[model samples]
Target: MNGPDILASLRANLAQQVQHYISPIPAPLDVSPWLAMALLQKAIRRGHHPFALQAAATLLQLSPDKLWRRAVSIAFEDIGIADLEIVSLVTASLAGKAFRAKIGGEWLVASYLVERMCLAPKCRSADDLLMLSERHPAYEHLRLGLTYGTIPELLALVRSNAPLPKRALALWYAVGSDRCPSPQLRTRKGAPQTVFDDLCEAGHPHTLVEVAREGFRRSGQVLCPFVVLLASQKSEQPAFIEDDDFPPETMCGSLPSWALDVYSREGQQALRRFLGRNCDTARWVRSHVPPVQRIKFLGDILFAVEGGLLRNHYRWPLADELRRSWAIECQGPFCPDAGEIMSMLRIDIQLLNEERQHV
Candidate 1:
């Protein structure tokens, strides 16, 4: 065939190939090696340029593996930062599909040309450069000398400089707001159980503050133990003096003003009415107050006392006298039906004693 006829035939074949292979979403650019090679071969047959034909041939000669690697690179470099989801989806899809092995030599070259033409070039700025450096310090030296002018240049730089894991991390951070500082920190293996021990031991304000700051740094979330410890430290109230000899009503009245705020109005009224009606009639009180109700009330009172004692280990001076009267009236051998109430009160006493040991 004559040179002009061969050139015309090559152009017609390339146009057919383009229609068959390339998807028509983004406008196809001249960056495609397959397209460039076809055009270059046609021009060379027409005696146009030897250097251009050699360049296209060299690009066409790239192995499938190298071309697929370039495609993966373009996925991240071109689609990353601006629309990082595309990078993730493309990378995952490529990995899952095993595109390099599936496409084979010539087809792989054609696929690269199509992909390169279809996707937009991504650009990275000084901010992205700094962030990349922070994310992967290993690449700091390589990134130092390069100055990127376009999206394609930035993508090329990333492909050359960043490792697969670093590329994945950068893509993850770019795609989602829930980026973790390090994978180890996010995983269970990186967290230490001793941090919880420290929080539990954080009895004072200073220690709790330190635990909170350290916990936040170690894990993105706050540790519950430190929060509890801090709350306990901050809510500590002043000690109240208890009068053992005073009536239950009088003792309740003598409670600190701040202590009154702890209970709801209804609870305060119920407690006050119970104390007022039962202060002198111990026998009647035991009969009216059911064993279960007495036990529940005692449990609540014991919890309050333990919390109060932790804040300030003050003796309720009235506690001994009240206990003496309660023991006599509720546990006395002469009192009939005292057995059940006494049994419930004894259980409360045991719980109270246990709480004291912990304090």
Candidate 2:
């Protein structure tokens, strides 16, 4: 297809894909970055770099600040309460003139859609909040609320706030922004009075102002005033905020606790049965597998478990053991020069785990 026709086709495809994946408000075309990128990509793919640059400029027609502001708006509005990283990255890239590739901008936009659809963590951040506030006053209130409040309080404010812009602001602030009171504080004891928790509990709008001020004292952050403003504007209870650190097992949707409990019981039984059935084979495999291979296999198995993925779980002990063993194993003359074989075994284990999860 010619440039214009290719652009139109790509735009239509992107709109359909985005809507299919995200069901964004006010149709996908209203936020033109995706389309602009698509047009740019088409130009570049056809070896038309000069035309691509002109097309991109004509399509955005935005000052750097305006483009960034619009990008943030799209990031929060369409991507919504999902990942903030893509939004943050895109905004930063645009602001800093870092994404100069012909297809780089479009790739970034497409990546956001893909990540959102896949339910991965969207790395949006507090920087997006600051940018939105500077560009749009309506968004400033929402950003203020989120910056100051805890996750729960932010959720409550968003649900009851009026005016689509106000509600959008709340989503922008609460979900899109990624500021938190440090991962260390997450484990602290006692029902601490977080801006989030306070918003969740406050009975009156006036209470939010005082709470917001107090939140600033406690957190020493600048987002408190906006949190107080959102709380003051709304007067209804909101849904419970999804606890951030709740085990991923709870959020996977496909694996219910009961099913996992049953799976755990059955998995144990299956392991025992296989062991009994293949005791001879298991021993033979173990004996035949080199020491390095065995150690590597054990490490691979540990990583396969969901709990093992946590930093505290695997980093220190497993890493230390691997390093110590690697020194000894590499020095030995009879270390079963099966490097390719061991590599294949690790790959096989990973593939097996992936297949099991799919089943």
Candidate 3:
């Protein structure tokens, strides 16, 4: 099937009158769990509530647990610091089937929370800071050295007037290096509750700490701490504003570019074809990357330069710095040629994205 057009358009259009985000994209619903999940988060970030709702509903049908998991992550990951009340709402919604059943029923509660998150202002600095802390060359010394600090020492450092990145390291060690959400750091012993408790004891708000604690309990994302820490900064007041870069986007048959994420079936095929090209990005990866890992490595680079973020980003001083660090530091990690490869992919990927139109 190329894509569902006529019937889906009618069903989706009819859905628009009763509820706003209930209307899905006028495309096929035979989407994978990965694609549905991706569309959910990206749609929320882009403020495309219709697709967000559709994706959430799809997950509710195919994988109820993933629907809850992704919603919780998006809450802490996307809407961090912009609206704590919304974060707490999303966190509470994840309690369990019993809680959701008591609140209203599963769909009513899930759909309402999903729509609320879609409309909420977003801040991704926490996630950006995670990437920077993990892979940025500037943080290598901090990562290695802090890996050796005692829990008390690290906790003390976390509350001191240190730079944000150092605080990130101290916080990481204090919590335990074992919570490797990306599978990067490993083998350190510490309890996550201790980190949250110390943050509260060190003068952070109890409510915010509770939000992060619950989020961390549910998602196991290191980003949870980063969210509270980034918000608790007393160094300066950073101005927040909206920014839409309007990156190249178009429809492939009926599905929007937002649905054409790296994990989608069609997207995987496109990347495979792009890799056969003689472009600098493809050439460097072919020669530098191991034969078994080429696709994974190249896909990471593509995700970095391409639609890995909102076409519209919530911008602020510290968040923008973290974003820049992500652009420079996170390209597939462990590859010396990632800088040159990312530069090439930024240009070459457009040609590939254009080809997606006719495919």
Candidate 4:
């Protein structure tokens, strides 16, 4: 199969309302539960959600309780701070009857599991620490606490063993303090809420916008007003403006840009005009709609692109533009300038040429 041709075809069909790409559900293998579960873990770790989902479903068919337990374990061990929401989401799925019920219930569970796992950022620090705690003499208490006690219980044990390993303790605090919504486990109090909660509390509607703003603050970059307004909506508990009102003039400012050199004079003017139109639309949306309804219209584009699922579903021109903008801004505050970009391009070309010669 030609790679470029495949990409072109995929992009061409991106605008279609229906899904053209359907991955085959995995068939069950006559393997041990441990081995099959291991394979499922590998697929999920590699972000092969389609394969992982199918494999998990096959495993679940063999033993639902076991597979559900394994999924919960993987959530805490493998996926840590990279995605704080996965544990709760997986816990919800485990308790959910949707996985066992007929009439598309099984598929619904599989879809939810796979999409969340695939979209979440992967990290294994918690996994590594858990492994070390099993053998390390100093971590014996920590290991026992993890095995038999709640997160806070484990933290209390580790806190007493402070001089053992500060880094490991920090990792435990970071991952363990997250709220676990599973009904089966002992709930810990004063745990850090979900990222969405934090963002919502701080008055930012969009996750990427909050991330981008933090990136700019760390790197001394300017944030565009349009992106800011697009990130924030009419706040529910507002102190300054009315809950329904939007301040258009206050929202137009500079956005972080790496392509600004290329977008000089007329380019900047054209971009501003484009932003202006968007700003007007945003203002209209805020004024006409309730705060609850306005968030989806303003923030869904960034979230969709961040998860890489929106591109697969919608090919609206505006969505495409937002994807491109996200691609640029999501690189954090300091993007590579033209010269650095050209250098990387040259390196890539050189490697491609070398591969071709060898072939």
True-structure RMSD, every candidate: 34.0, 21.4, 8.8, 22.4
Prediction 4 global C-alpha lDDT: 0.37
Candidate 2 stretches with Cα past 4 Å from truth are 1-62, 94-359
Error of 2 at 359 (Å): 54
Off by over 4 Å in 1: 1-60, 83-93, 96-121, 125-127, 130-359
Pull out the clashing pairs in model 1: 122-151, 123-151, 242-318, 243-318, 244-317, 244-318
User: Which of the predicted structures, 1 or 2, would earn the higher lDDT when compared with the native?
Assistant: 2
lDDT score for candidate 1 against the true structure? 0.31
- Encode model 1's per-residue lDDT on 193-308: one tens digit a residue: 33333333433233333333332332333221223221342233332422222111111231211122113342334333343332333234446656445433433332222211
Could you tell me which residue pairs clash in candidate 3?
none
**Model 2 misses residue 290 by how many Å?**
83
* 1-359: candidate 4 lDDT, tens digit per residue: 23234333332332231133243464565544554465455456546665566557667678766566666555544443345445435534443454334213454555555656655654443333332332234444543344345444433543343532332432233233223222222223332223223333445434333332332222221111122222232132222211111111111112111111111342233223322332443344445546544433222222222212211121223223333443333322223112333233223322222222221
TM-scores, each model vs. reference: 0.21, 0.20, 0.83, 0.35
Report lDDT (Cα) of residue 145, candidate 4. Answer: 44
Best by lDDT: 3
lDDT of 3 by residue, 230-306 (tens): 88752366565575553566776645664665677777667777778878877888888787777777777765666
- Measured with C-alpha atoms, the lDDT of residue 337 in candidate 1 is 38
**TM-score-best of 3 and 4:** 3
- Whichever of 1 and 2 has more TM-score, that candidate is 1
Clashes of each: 6, 14, 0, 4
Instruction: Provide the lDDT at 333 for model 4.
Output: 21
